[model samples]
Target chain A: MLKIMIIGATSVIAQETARFFATEGAEFFLVGIPADKLVVIKDDLVARGAKRAEVYEADLTDFDKHPQIIESAVQAMGSIDAVLIAHGTLGNQKAAEASVEVALKEINLNLLSNISLLTLLGNYFEKQRRGCIAVISSVAGDRGRGSNYVYGTAKAGTTTFMQGLRSRLAKSGVAVVTIKPGLVDTPMTADIKKNFLFSDPATVGKAIYLGMKKGKDTVYAPWFWRYIMAIIIHIPEFIFKKMSL
Target chain B: MTTPLNRLKQYKSWGRYPTVEHKAIHQIHWRSDLPDVNQFEETVLPYGYGRSYGDSCLNEGGILLDTSYMQQFIAFDAEQGLVRCEAGVSLEQILEVIVPCGWFLPVTPGTKFVSIGGAIANDVHGKNHHRAGTFGCHVTQFELVRSDGTYICSPTENAELFRATIGGLGLTGIITWAEFKLKRIPSPLIDQEKIRFANLDEFFAISAEMDQRFEYLMSWSDCLSGGDSMGRGIFMAGNFYDPPLGAEPSAKKLKPFVPFDLPSIALNTLSVKAFNAVLYRVPLGKRVRSIVHYEPFYYPLDAINNWYRLYGKRGFLQYQLVVPLEGDNEPIREVYRRIAQSGEGSFLVVLKAFGDIASPGMLSFPMPGVTLALDFAFNGEKTLKLLDELDTIVREARGRVYPAKDARMSPENFRAYYPQWEAFAHYIDPKFSSSFWRRVTASAKSANGQ
Candidate 1:
């Protein structure tokens, strides 16, 4: 069976993502921060039809501990075919302005933490020369606006870093995909607009699953987002900067 | 009549036949009748229609068994759309009988002159190659006559031999007959959309977008242009024609065959370049969808019968190669640069996307990549040298030249392209050989000698 490790397994997206990979006959290495929540998620994944599921509790902010955590995961499950990096904190922008520490924490969790994990995974995957790294960035990164510029900036950096990694690892047989999701309605975005153009966490998870198989370099969560963002980002700067998106 | 057999020899008459090498010659003892094929064993090269543009047919004094007269359909299942026929049958022959019945060959090469055996041997690709893959992908099964003089090979039994034989260049054995899956169509016509692009970037974007809907796609490039216009071409995307009310009569007319060869200098660089320029300039729009006949859409050059004669007495060499899309167009750009510098203007340059479907043949040509095919007249020693240089480029890029259209590629190039060549060679019957096989193997041996 193919070994797949999903970082941040207790998250809402991870629940559906784990279940999807399980039904596809993959052995799962679900990693999250909390032990009790991971146990419940693991049971849910197996009850939903996972062949085998293992959970690990590790804080992603502990950069030095990532290597061992990943090594243990790879050891628990046999050779890993894919690494899904789906860990991030969507801190409230208004609250972030109250404290510089909070703003830095948002950047650390969203950008630096994912970069550290990817750097470690990049070296491992490059040596193996055959694996996939699927990163979940948001469409907010397509262009920074007043509404979510802080979160968008972090995602933008993540997306760019993935592009560079994709180019470097192309000939080595390792594929790096940057998934840009638009207005996803998860617990992460529960208080946002109800009738807004938004994709569910399951829909985004399925898109990621299919995009990896197709070897697409960058995928918009819902394909319409490709054209939607194309037009949105192409508007003149004067007009785009004035609009409160 | 028995007075003097020597005196009777002076009155003997000989009839000329066309060959793949563009040479007209008389057949010695070889005839179509199977009983008269005592000279034919496993070593003999069986040729039909003689449209292979290279030495695949002429074995250079070796036994050449003519299979053109083996044209007869054994069975046809209208319900399932399956066809079983002798190897000698031609596409034109099938079209004549089946077009009225609303059936068509699943895959066809550029020309209708190819035989069923030649099609299987070459594993021909058509406009729809991007979506459907190669000819071997659709072939259900074929009966191969092996060295043991026993014909007992199908897709399931002797599976390796079946895979090797399809694109094996007739090296494994003689293909006596084949059963293929036929495609059912509304009529012998096409609904085409001509989309023109000013430069390479537009061409790439247009082709990728059109690939979503169209079943058939082919592009024509102006090889004479350089720099920004290097890969500038026109894209022709089409699907099976759907006739409008009260307009079905035109599709029923039988196409007249081209009986005579054209003038020698009819297709010069200036003429072809001018023709391509006009073709590229005429269709200037997002999409121009219209009703067109099948002969023009699928076989555009077939309008001029004996079109190869236009290349002069020297014949022509077709170079076809496929390179994986490594997310960069630099390799393709380099090839076009080399060809442009060579000052050899090709009459027809076709570019297509080879889809995700893998080839079943151990040595089949098409893979998940982008394929470029061009035709050049044999302009003496320089033409061969230019092709060899291009072969080197392809080899370095981990790409391969199509064996069916190749006459000059070294065996090293063959091995590099088909990693399973040794495995394919294991299935080769000693009794079966062709001039194409001898030249390639000898070239390979010499390369190894060096």
Candidate 2:
């Protein structure tokens, strides 16, 4: 049975991605905020055929707690054979635009906290010598847009960090997969008006599960997002800045 | 908390009919975050996937508390074929988890995309209704969150509310999660057979015989067939194939999708007639047999996602009505005759017999009846007129139209069909209401001068 650690067990995308692992009779060390929601996910993973799903309730934004959280999860699961960091807020772009404090807070939760967990897990996995490390970055990181630049900045930082982690651990036999998903319908994006560009969480989740299992280096969920993001990324800065995306 | 994304959104029932008035959506992602039902200034109703064909799952001028993200599996017992899952979990998702463990849904509707909560609220029946009854019959327990508080409902706990909630059309409250039993299956593949019947009499005769041995039975009828050929169509029967069956149960594959609406001229009467003729001649009463995957056996149309787009911009209506089995099937034969006369019937038609097993839901639609369901492209007044005539015949025959598939049944007809609405109304959550609830209840109340 696989032993895995999921950082954001409560989020819809995280739960959906975790389900693939669960059905394979994986054992889980789940960490997320809100104890009740975490417990619900734990029960859910077990129901989906997981051998065990242990919950470690923690506010992932609390950076000081990162070491303890990682240690506790690894201890609880015996030892993690794979790790997925799937927690982050969309972080209201308008609110962040209104205040520097909001922007920093958004970055702290989405970028800095993840970096802390990565550093801790990085050391543990590097010593263990074999494992898959996956993180959910977003296509928004390809190029910042006015509508959600705050979130874009955080995702961009995350993508860059995973890139460095991948190269640094290349010889250590540690695999790093960076997942950039576009427009997934989850509670995080519940407020967004959905269109053809959007896909259900299950679709994106299955992609993540497959990418992690295959140890793909960099991936885009739902495939189409790659072409969409490529077009967006190639748009000239002069014309792009004039148009609201 | 409203954002650019939370602007008032126009939602469509799967059938895309009656044009729902716009409503703001408040998403409920976690049980801990469930909104206070009484707190919304606009009335509230839970919306899950909008898979219901008509307005039963919609709300006009109210907040749609969307529960699609509330999907999660709570418990599973492969040994006993028991599962408890969040209400928003789709049958498709459940199949992914349980099919490997050798369990299957006790009952399933045509589409696997429907949420468990929607299935329960509609009390959807399936081909296996002859043996398994409606989906609600297997729901062992669920959590209903109302304006008052959360209540755990089952047959023995809050029993009346449980009955009302089943087939309650989101009026009772939000079903946060539910527990139900699953039937054991040897494998996910179906050993299916097809035979063409000459007419309605032969169809019924063969159906009854197949019901004795098969776990699933259904028929596809030519909607425009009449007189001697009336109800002549293909009868299909199947059971889950036992043993590994020499082939691994293949994974659910990506379905081809209709990316955009087909033009209105694409499915006219002549075209539908030609298609029906081709289908009718292919089977030829040969009793062809094959071992097929359950995906195709139960949901052939699902092979193409958004296949209803073929009906074009105006959308379509799925007029499904069940005529009781107590009398001669003259009324059913009459329904086919009327549709054939209208020249508006589409190629797709389904006929099935519900057995004597009674559904526990007070508002449940099945009652020892043969249900006829056909699709009609909305031709404005002409199609509406035809359906209205069918309703009169059905009402006189003590038949009932399925609310889940109805967009335009009159309030009087609805009350006539489901007289237990008064008992069910008593259990409706004070804070929960829907477009359909308002259409039937409010109009009926005003008509009575109450």
Candidate 3:
């Protein structure tokens, strides 16, 4: 069984991804912000056939605590086979535009915090020379939409950082998977009006798990998002800037 | 009141027969955070999956406690083959974890999209009902959360609540979590056999013989068949098969999809007849025995995601009724004859014989009878009138219609089929009500001069 560590275990996509691994009888060290939610997810993982599921409550934004969290997870599992980073938020774009404080707070949580954890994990995995790291980015990162530019920018930063991390870790035999999901019907997107294009969390979760196992560098949930995003990325900047998305 | 978590929305059942405007909808994430049925100023009804196909899952001008977000597996005992999961967990989710481990649901409905809670509430039956009984028979226990407090109910503990909650249409309370036994299967493949029967008597004879040996038994009838050809269809039976270790469960991914709604004209008489004709001819003259994956054997319709879109935006009313086979199946034949004569044909006409195992639910729909289910495109009054006629035939036969699939069932017939409605009513949380309950009760009260 694979020894997996899931950061932001309480998030809908993370919980679903954990369940995918749990079904394979994997060992898990779950980290989330809320202790209660973590306990619930941990119990659920065990029920889904996880050999072992342990949870730690720690805010992912606390950069200083990243090393300790990674250490605890490694100690709990003995060895880490894979790590899934699925904690991020769709911050209020209007509020972020109005105040630098909101923008910085979102960036810290969605981008910087993840980079800190990745750095710590990178060092450990580089030394060990084996493991897989997967993170959930968004289709919004392909192009900045005025509606959610702040959140999009954070994901864009993470996606680029993952590219660099994947290239650096390639020689060391560590796989870095950047998962870009489009319009997932998760609790995070509960407020957003959904259409036919929306993907279910369960579907996205399976894709993330399978892509990580296959050692893919960049994976798109729903598969169709790859082609859709390709067209969106190539839209002329002058026309894209003038048109509201 | 305007919070994203608790916002007013218009919701409809899978049938899309009746759309109701609810005061608000609260998507429950944690069982601890669930409000009591009485806690809401407006009435509350727990809605799961929204695949009930009728008004049973809907509440008008009330609060719908959406439980889809409450999905979580709590505990599982591999040795005991028991699974405990939050009520919102879908059968599809459970199958993902258990199927690979040589375990399967004791009873599964046509689609795996329905939630565990919804399955229990409807006390749904599968083709193997002749062997396994309704879904509730396998349910060991479930916690019912009400306005007063949460209560644990099982066969031996708070047994009345357990009986009432099953097939209670979610009136008793919101089921927080449930534990049920899973049947152990040797492999994810089924040894399937399909035989075409010429008439109702042949169908019955074939079913009786198959039920004695097969683990699962069901049939599909061409509703347009009449005269000597009436009830002519294919009888299908399956048993679990052992496959080689290299043989894997069909990957859940790669579903064939129906991207958009088909025009209403696409399901018209000419089109439906054409489709049914082609489908009925599929078996041909060859011996219809094959080793098939459990996915196709159990959930053939699931192959096409959103196949319901074929019914169009107006949706179709799925009229399903069961009549006991005490003397003969004349009453059952009469119901089919009326549908055939009316020229209102359902694309999917499933005829199955229910086994004699009585469900523990007070208002469970299935009994020792033959059930005929048909989907009539919603053409307003025309379809409703046709359904009323079918109900009359069912009432005369002493069989009842399934409430979970009914958008329109006369209260008189419902009372006749389930005389235990008055007894079941006492257990209904006053804080809970549904559009189906309101429609049936109000009509019944009016008929009784109330």
**Which number leads on DockQ?**
2
- Give the CAPRI class of candidate 2: acceptable
lDDT of 2 by residue, B1-450 (tens): 001121232467878887777467778778668988777777888887777888887888888888766777888898998899888788888888888888999999988878889999999989999999999999999999999989999999999989999999999999999999999887777777888888898887777788998889988888787888888888888988875546554545312221211223344434887877777877545697777778777876655656667777798998999988754688988888888898986777889888989888999998888888888888999999999999988898898999999988888888888989998999988888888888876556434422
Please, what are the lDDT tens digits per residue for candidate 3 over residues A115-229? 8988989888999999899998888888899899999999999999999999999999999999999987777887787677887777888888899989998889989999999
Candidate 3 chain B minimal-lDDT segment of 10 residues? B1-10
Best by TM-score: 2
Deviation from truth (RMSD, Å), model 3: 4.7
The residue pairs that clash in candidate 2, if any, are A191-B5
Clashing pairs in 3: B37-B147, B38-B147
- Distance from true location, Cα of A41 in model 3, Å: 2.0
Cα deviation at B72, candidate 3, in Å, is: 1.8
TM-score of chain B of each: 0.86, 0.92, 0.92
DockQ of each: 0.00, 0.43, 0.33
| Candidate 3 CA-lDDT value | 0.85
Candidate 2 share of real interface contacts = 0.52
Error of 3 at B62 (Å): 2.5
